[model samples]
Target: MSSLDILIFIAYGLVILLVGNFLHRSKEKENSSSNYFFASNSLPWYLIGTSIIAANISAEQFIGMSGSGYAIGLGIATYEWIAALILIVVAKYFLPILIKNEIYTMPQFMAYRYDNRIKTILAVFWIALFVLVNITSILYLGALTIKILLDIPLIWAIVGLAVFTLLYSVFNGLKAIASTDIIQVFFLVSGGLMTTYLALNATSDGNGIIEGFKIIANEAPEKLHMIIKSSDPNFTYLPGWRAIFGGIWIAGIYYFGANQYIIQKALGAKNLREAQRGMAFAGFLKVLIPLIVVVPGIAAFVLDAKIDTPDGAYPWLLNTFIPSGFKGFIFAALIAAIVSSLSAIINSTSTIFTMDIYKNFFHKTASEKQLVKTGRLSGVLAMIIAASVAPLLGRVEQAFQFIQEFTGMLSPGITAIFILGLFWKKTTSNAAFFGIIISLPASIFLKFVFPAMPFLDKMLCAFLFTSFFMVVWSLLEGRMKTYPKAINVDKRMFKTDRVFNMVSIGIFIMLLALYIVFW
Candidate 1:
């Protein structure tokens, strides 16, 4: 790497740390649980929107997404596009309930709908998931990607990202995270687009964007196809359209709507209105991610990038496609993305642990100051656990698959509880409680005993079984004592304000155009 490149990378890292520390220091005394955990419920729709997308679409999207596209053409886009549709459901239906109830974490919602026991159990489950799946898998994969590109040691990268994230989350809390995310997101988008454009130009050899497509069309026609054939090695093509539409759709809804890491940003909304707008904003962002992450892989294939493993496509491009000085900036952006995601997890994990577990179960009368302090302590502790465990995740071949395969187990169980708990007033707490428990064994059976079925199919079976049992138990044993009184729905919350909608509409149109152009 050139001296200029190294300078750029250093500049990027320094800038992020400075900005994050600045935010943390600025808000030190605003250290209430709401401020630390939810940005004092003051984030506008735009910040909430960008932060959610940035948090969810970290190195996993940068690394694993292109790999999936390389391995399976556009078939992997099911994750992004399906999530777009699910965001609509969440914004329209679920956001109101969560915002109205003032849920600090996903488990807090469980406590409200069911009981403290279920809340504590789910909180512990979530904390474990964060360390095992999120901090370990996502952080490890992200660090590995950086290590490969920059020739830094993987362990150092993990520690660097973890410590940087821990500093802000431990001291400043979610306000710092959400605020820094506003800046980090700009780099994430700019860096992704920069790499994509350069890759396309290199593939076309200055022939222009049109020739990039021609090169791809002539060189590897299979890479351009959206539909996968049964013989496709990348993903299973069996079980017909049911797997694609029904099974995948159900999973997508569960993931985007109920997943803690993704939805926690929205849960911290300033109000019902901001939360709804934030969901719409994130939905629009998801639509553009394919353009940045997937399009580059197509360019890589056309460029004949050493494609032994699809996972290598992204890192290879980062090394060869970008110029040196700019490479540092992009590297900085990647680190920023990693840090942003890590801080979000640390914050939410602390929230769940402190409120749902520590206070509710361990210290019933803990003061507000004590709760906030405990949250900070939990954040630090969670960071230590995540950093320690992250090294184990370095072996994951594809970041996306590792996340989905593991989180799929927990997501479905939680989704069932939330869906029935929120929408069905008659859903007895007992039923919701048992419903989540039963899903585990059923999912385990399907995963270990019957690998022949697509994982989605197994999830569907488990979900249906749990849903069936919940309904039967609700009817036979008893109903909820009373329909929980409805929280006032803010009409202003559901309405899309003018400022974000204008840009969101443009992105939506662009997304539609891409679908048509690629279709």
Candidate 2:
């Protein structure tokens, strides 16, 4: 990129930091643990929705998923499209229970439903995972983008991204993170669409988006199919029909429903209605994500761009097709995606550690001011560790697939525990603990023992196995003398505003149409 592009990128970062700091300072009077971690439970629907998407659609989606799109075609979009459905389910079913509990963290919810032992165990696990895996991977991918596009050293790029994220997020906490996410989402979507448009126009030699579509269809129709046959050696990761009706939901529900960082925005909403509405809004955005992240890869394919690796597809498109000033804008958008995610997971890592581990175990009598201080310190420490470890992840071929395969092992068991705990009063704490403990081993056994079985199918098998053990163990233990106060199981709690309902239906219909057209 030219010097002008670098200036534009720097300008974007300054704007975000200023906006976030301004908003955070505006709320200085309400300094408390609740304010720091949950945004004082005052976020409106639009902020919640945009923050959710901003936190979710990071380097993984832009870099890794786009790479998959280049390598495996539109079938890779099954993850994005299916996540829309999962978000709807999470909003209607999961948010009500969580909001009613007035819980700050997922592990806290586990503690309430079962025991502190469970909460402490999961809390430690999530903190370690976030620092070691989530933050590290995001930083690595983001730095990789800058290194490739700007000829910068990878270590310097990693440090730059980490410092930029910490500037906006570490001091003010979730309030700052959510407020800045609004602007981040704007850049993320608009810049992404701009890149897509340019790539498509490039494919068609400046004719039009419609012409570009026709070129891709005429040249490589196979890339447009949403479904792939199992026998096709090229697309084994997405094993045909199972992509629709199999282990994907286990992964999806765990992410949208059970994950701390993704659901923290919802938990911070002004009201349950706003949270539900925000999730529905996010679901709507999910439908559009693939257009920005995935279609450019297909554009690269149709234009016959020379890319040595699948992950190179997006960077190649940006370097080749985007103009100088516009390239800076898109680069800023890419940084926005990366920083938004980094800020989010960093906040959550601090949240889990502060509320679940530190407050619970270290200082039960700690004041609200002290709690906030602990959270900030934890956020800095987590970022330092992640930045230190991120460069080591460069060896992985497809960072996206690596994340999915590893996370899938834990998701199935966690999903099972939550599903039963929410709906089944008979489920004993022992059963839930056992389910969580057995998931990884079962997933690994299936992966290595039956090497031919697809990963999604393996996830399904592990989920079922964990679930069976839960039910059998619960039945053997008999009903607890007293169960956790059953979550407000009333159907009224699940009701949505009329606008949300209408938009949800519209999103569902659009998804159906896409599947029918692409099937």
In order, candidate lDDTs are: 0.75, 0.88
Instruction: Output the number of the lDDT-best candidate.
Output: 2
**In model 1, which runs have C-alpha deviations exceeding 4 angstroms?**
25-28, 237-244, 395-406, 448-450, 479-519
Assess candidate 1 and give its lDDT: 0.75
Give lDDT tens digits, candidate 1, residues 324-390: 7888777777776777888787877888888778887789999767888898888888877777877
The candidate that wins on TM-score is 2
- After TM-score superposition, what is the CA distance of residue 366 in candidate 1 from its true location, in Å? 2.8
Extract clashing residue pairs from model 2: none
Tens digit of per-residue lDDT, candidate 2, span 420-470: 888787777888888899988999899889988888888889999999998
> Which run of 10 residues does model 2 get worst, by summed lDDT?
479-488
